[model samples]
Target chain A: MLNIKDLHVKLEEEDKVILKGVDLDVPAGAVHAIMGPNGSGKSTLSYVLSGRDGYEVTAGAATLDGADLLVLDPEERASAGLFLAFQYPVEIPGVGNMTFLRTALNAQKKARGEDEVSAGDFLKLIREKAKSLKIDADMLKRPVNVGFSGGEKKRNEILQMAMLEPKMCILDETDSGLDVDAMRLVSEGVNALRDAGRSFLVITHYQRLLDHIKPDVVHIMANGRIVKTGGPELALEVENNGYADILEEVA
Target chain B: MGLPADKSDATADRLAALTMPDGASWARIAREAASTRFQAMGLPGRRDEYWRFTQPDTLNAIQPPEAALYPPEDPPAFSALDRLSVVFRDGIFDPEASDDLALEGLEIERLSTATQADFHWAKDLYGVLETRGQDPVERPFAALNTAFATDGVVLRATKKILKPIHFRYLHEKTDSDAILHFVVRVEEGAELTLLEGGPAAARFNKCMEIDVADRGSFHHIRAQGRDHERRAVTHLFARLGEESTFKSFTLTANGRLTRNEAVIELTGDNATAHIAGAAVGDGDFHHDDTVFVTHDAVNCESRQVFKKVLKNGAVGAFQGKILVKEGAQKTDGYQISQSLLLDEDAQFLAKPELEIYADDVICSHGSTTGAIDEEALFYLRSRGVSASEAQDLLVLAFLAEAIEEIESEEIADDILTRLESWLVRHRG
Candidate 1:
């Protein structure tokens, strides 16, 4: 469902190459996890895939179900079923969470020539989803990410992804600030969204979340390239032994 | 170094004398009082304390006589909605288009012929809460307005009256200067919401005096004209009663030279007041909003927020002062003034002052002036929102803090729509 062949990305206004000759593919109904040490292009890959500005795709191509993803803007990529769980969601004051979510959903629907959701139905759906995510009713009334705790913001990101129901979701360090309970709750929300037609590219450094979601494959990335691919057991090995040994072997 | 001083002085004298109201028993007294104040203050100069932050030269050059007092050539038809409408043409009251507005325990009428009983309450309270003597500057126009002020509106809500009141002050262009004075009194335990619009053509000077009796409440919203050529100064002075609440909002979208002076005095214990204003100026428009709040009783609270958007030689100023008098303990006051300067030629000045003679009071003031954040711009652009659209959203958000306080839903929505359109036009 998602493909990136020999992707090479460079930082804008500089010759520094952050991602070099990386290849990755996730088939339908599959979950993929990428583990890497700091400075190993973990976030750069996500930024490049998400089509964020300031990251130039120096070479290669990225596609979602045979359609070019690199050519689309972030919102277009979002409407095309591509979701990126930001490491730090931006705080947008005065833009209520419910309003922002409804706008995004309606924009996506409008792009696809679908009927717009009524306010009543939208409120109902959001309430149900937010409840399952352990989100308070008042949280949706506040500005997006404004005054939200670190863990609450992460959970809200997943809640948005659940509401969006994207075809391919890239989770980048979503577990960094979650407590034990919040991590389990967030993992459960992500797990409930898993199905035969969805794909996930979970990026993380800890094995704790993987134990809950259980990815189908794990890839080791270093120096902007994926040098190792194995089943879910590789996550445990990397977690116990750390990424230094893997980095040496990959180099 | 500039235009000859005598030429301007002679011009002002001609204009003031030329614009005096027509013959009436009260006209002489009004003119005498007005000329006395005008003579004492002359035209506000740069050296004046209150005129320090404001451009007094432009005001000095203005000497408009009473503008044309005629009906609108083609007045916009009012919709079928059951609203109490009062229309003014060129600063003259028009009874043909106004509603009688007979609500229980409330009276809305033109000030010209109101009986002694009708104005007895206002006459007892008018100018009782004065800021001129407190500030060392002689406000030439305010004094002039007071001296010549006549025949506007007297809206009084009796005790415990809850009905809303709508006031529309429409200003049309005339060849002369126009001035209006409004008096409002909300009696004890009475509540009133006032929606006022200075939708006028250039050449109108408006002043409003309001007082809230013990336990009375008042909410006033005013939108100034949207013409850079029009020159205006609107003074709003309000006094709050015990346990009473007062809130006022002033919006300045366009004007050549406009000033809105709002004063709220919490004279009763546990009284609260909030004063907020927003202005977006373009061309050589100059807009200033000066707010003053005094807490005289214990446990009173006051808040002031002001925002301005300037572009292309436009100038904006915000000078807010909060005072806590002696024995007014436990006073809580917060003030903030911010501006977004869109062009180098555009200038903004924000001055926030606090004077607290009482101990154990919480008061703080903040001011910020800067362009939009580039990082946030990049983020919005990355999301596919065009630069102009993103800016419009941000600017609206910046101004929303003040606009949101408006109590009237219909009027607030109308103002918001107008503001949105203004933002779109100026986004470039």
Candidate 2:
């Protein structure tokens, strides 16, 4: 479960409030979609929740499964079963994807006092997951995101989430640049990982991704605040009518 | 400066007058002429071009006298075993510490025994590849080495031996300057690998010449001296034959003041040469690598890559030049020098040059100096890798590009392990 209470975050040394008194909660086994226009602070909410720097949490609280997510560092949050699928995946040259994934997986395992996975087991798991995603074997050998197409990078983020098997995941605009075929692949990957014990917070500007994901709850966020909550039909309305209609209802 | 001035030299002269090694005749003449050159040029002053980036005061302050060939006052940490290892203590050969190599078709012996067989292979090639028209600022030190560097190894690969030859130099607390000259010839179609490393914790100067006959290949890896108070200057001049290849990898992980000069000439068509250097400095250490690759024949390919990581107010220097002569058409040359400064006070200076007279050639050079990427660090951190660990991995990746050129997997692994250890120590 994930919960945020009156989350207020401001950029360092600036009075501009990126996340203004936002509140949301996602119970286990539920899929939540947060939709808003540009600059509505959807990405900032994810980064602030993930504990990225340059943003000050002036006031508010964020908790995952009753544990303080805001107080933990980025790595600690990752170990605590929080995963953020970045909108723009970083290109890390000379760092092989397999090596980076193994490091992260084992680091979380170590943090949890669990036994580390054997190299053979790790390789097998990644190979199986990568096969299902239609990722070439060479992609695992190359540097992380280096030379990878935009769709490939987004798919890689999903592959990582699958490999990590985190309890809570926040995907930030993962379908922004994906073609219909790539989006189907991404949605299939996300669907494959769905379970009753995990929660996913999908953030996007378009309703196309929601058509495939079919969130259990939809929250319309406007001006850094969630104005309304509705069922899956809400996304279709926003898709057809846009944010002005939602903002007028909230006002 | 007052006690027993030149007593060891006087004694050496008296001994040379009586029971000098038969092969010492040419060495004697060579030594006298080198000494004269040193006296005429004197030690390099700050005004000299080559010495402009480096100061000679540290070396000039060392009043090294000719060492008396004596057994060690204490046991050395390293020993020569079944594998052939040439030992140099204080730049003087320790006959007791060396083993006679018995590989077939290969001739490995001390320079004092300079034989006709040795000259038949490499006599005509020695001293022909010196830095052209460049003044030797430390001429005195080089002259001293030329005069007294009596017994060094003269290795000849007779039948393309693949086994690596190891040269070990060990020095002690004494103030001594060593001049060592090495001549190696890989016969036509032969192959050889040489590993030269030493803990020469004193002022030392070295000159080595190698000739790779037509179709012969040579791989040379040199790990330089390490002493906070010592200075080291080393020169390597090599010529590659037609269709032959010469590759040199130098690792400078520890040193106070160190300079390495590499000059490689591809004299025959279809020759290939590569020079790679990686150095790390965590203290006030200073490391410099200057390499020149000349393409005199057609269809020659040459590459040079240098990487340095400097911290704690250290300095790193790299100067690389690739030259393609008029007729050396179809020459493909590439050079790159990159440095990572880990500390605010660390500094790096890199210069890359390409001189091509042939219009049909491909030549390019690049140099970059920067700190570690902060965004990359954040990404690694977000992935659960600690900051220091991330830095270490990035630095290793930076240097691995050069070290990966080594043909032998074992040697590459060994160098990587050593680099990891050095990073661990510095990070601690």
Candidate 3:
């Protein structure tokens, strides 16, 4: 469902290369985990795929279901079924969480030429979805991510993902600041959205999160490229040993 | 010392175009005193400290600058509320269009009729607060309005008012120069809400004096008219008694020049006051908010919050000060003024000051001018909101703090709706 081939990106303001050459493919219904060390361009990859500014695509292409994701604006990419759960969700003061969600949902619907959801239906739907993530009425009423705990921010992201129901999801370090309980809650929320037509590319530094939401495939990314691809045991190997061993072996 | 020759000449020329209306002996005395005060101060010159940021040439002109009437397609602001509507057409009191000037727990009278009476309660306050506010800083325009204004309303609340009083001004004449004065008194333990709206005239000068007695409360919400060519200068002077509450909020959109000045004095202990405004200006729009709050009693609190959204060469200015007197211990004062410049050409000038003679008071002030938060903007757009819609949301969020100062949720919502429309119309 998602494809990237020889994606080379550099900082737009400077001539520093971030992703030299990267290639990845996550088929429909597959959960792919990308494990990488710090400064290995994992977050940069996620940002580039989501159409963030300050990044210049020097070479190659990325697509979703054969649609050129590189050419579309961020919102258009979203309407094209691309969702990126930010590593750190923005704290937007004065914008209620519920209102943000509703505006986003309606905006995507309008962009896709679909009828907008009624307010009542939206409230009901959000309540049901948010309950599964343990988000209460007060959290929904408050400003988006303002004063939210790290775990709540992550869960809010998952709630957004579930509401958007994108065809492809990219979770960039979702387990970074979460506790064990919060990690489990967030993993469960993500697992609930797994279906035949959906795909996920989970980017992380640790293997513990994979225990909650099992991945179909694992890729060890290093030096701006995915050098190794294997089964879940690859993650176990890295967890027990380390990326040092893999890097040395690959070299 | 005498005034500068040019300043005196300008003030004289402006006053030459106005003929003071005849009134009772007391009213006549008050008008003459105000005129004397105004002449001494003279029209604010460009070199004046307070007028440096905004030019007063048009405001001091003899003839009112002509402004084409912009009859709003939408219904007037606060029209949905159950209110006692008082209408004015081009500065004249339109008795036929206004409701009966009577309500329970309240006494309301037209300024024209009130001044005509030989003995009236308004005579005590018509220009009393304006004269008091002139000290330390001169407000010559307010003095002029007090001296020559022949149209407005006098309101007194004896108890909690169930409905708000709405003053709706309509601009139907291109060169109409309207001067209006309002006097409000809230008795002890009484509560009242005052609502004002409209583009009164091509050039409008307005003055309002409010006295809130001990334990009384007064809420004011005003929406300046949407005439893009209109020029206006307004003054609001208020005195708060012991344990009283005073809150005022203004929402301004689309005017060529608007200067709103408010001076509040907390005289009795434990009183609270809040003043807030949100202005949106696009192209040739210049809006200024000048506020001064003084704390003279112990344990008083005051807050000022102003936000402006300027685009397409619009200019916004804010000058606010908080003064805590020597014996006003434990005073809590906070002030914040911010502007969102949508483009490179939009300008925001702010001056925030705090003068404290009491060492124990806690006063904080801040001013900021910036473009939209790019991170927040991208965050919204990444969630599928279009660029324009996302910017509008951020603009509303930026003004939300000022809008929150409105006590009524319904009114706050109405203000939000108006802001949204303004953003949509001015979207890039």
Name the candidate that leads on lDDT.
3
lDDT of 1: 0.76
lDDT per model, in order?
0.76, 0.78, 0.93
Q: Which TM-score values does chain B get in all models? A: 0.87, 0.85, 0.99
lDDT of model 1, residue B166: 54
* Candidate 2 residue lDDT tens string, A1-251: 99999999899878898888999999998899999988989999998887778899989899999999988988888889888898988888877899889988888898888999899999999999998899989999998899999999999999999999999989999998999999999999999989999999999999999989989999988888888899999999998999898899779
- What class would a CAPRI assessor give candidate 3's docking? high
Q: Write the per-residue lDDT of candidate 3 for residues B1-428, one digit (tens) a residue.
A: 99888878877887888889889999999999999999999988778899888988889898878999776638779988999999998888898999998889999988989999999988889899999899888999999999999799899999999999998989998999999999999999999999999989999999999999999999999999774588999999999999999999999998899999999999999999999999999999999999999999999999999999998899999999998989999999999999999999999999999999998988999999999999988888889999999999999999999999999999898888888887888888
Error of 1 at A61 (Å): 2.9
Q: Tally clashes: model 3.
A: 0
lDDT by residue (B221-317, candidate 2, tens digit) is 7766332445787777788899999988988776678888787888999999989988989886888887878889999999998999999988988
Task: State the weakest 10-residue window (summed lDDT) of model 1 chain B.
Answer: B72-81
Per-residue lDDT tens digits of candidate 1, residues B264-293? 778899998988888898887788887888
How should the candidates be ordered by lDDT, best one leading? 3, 2, 1
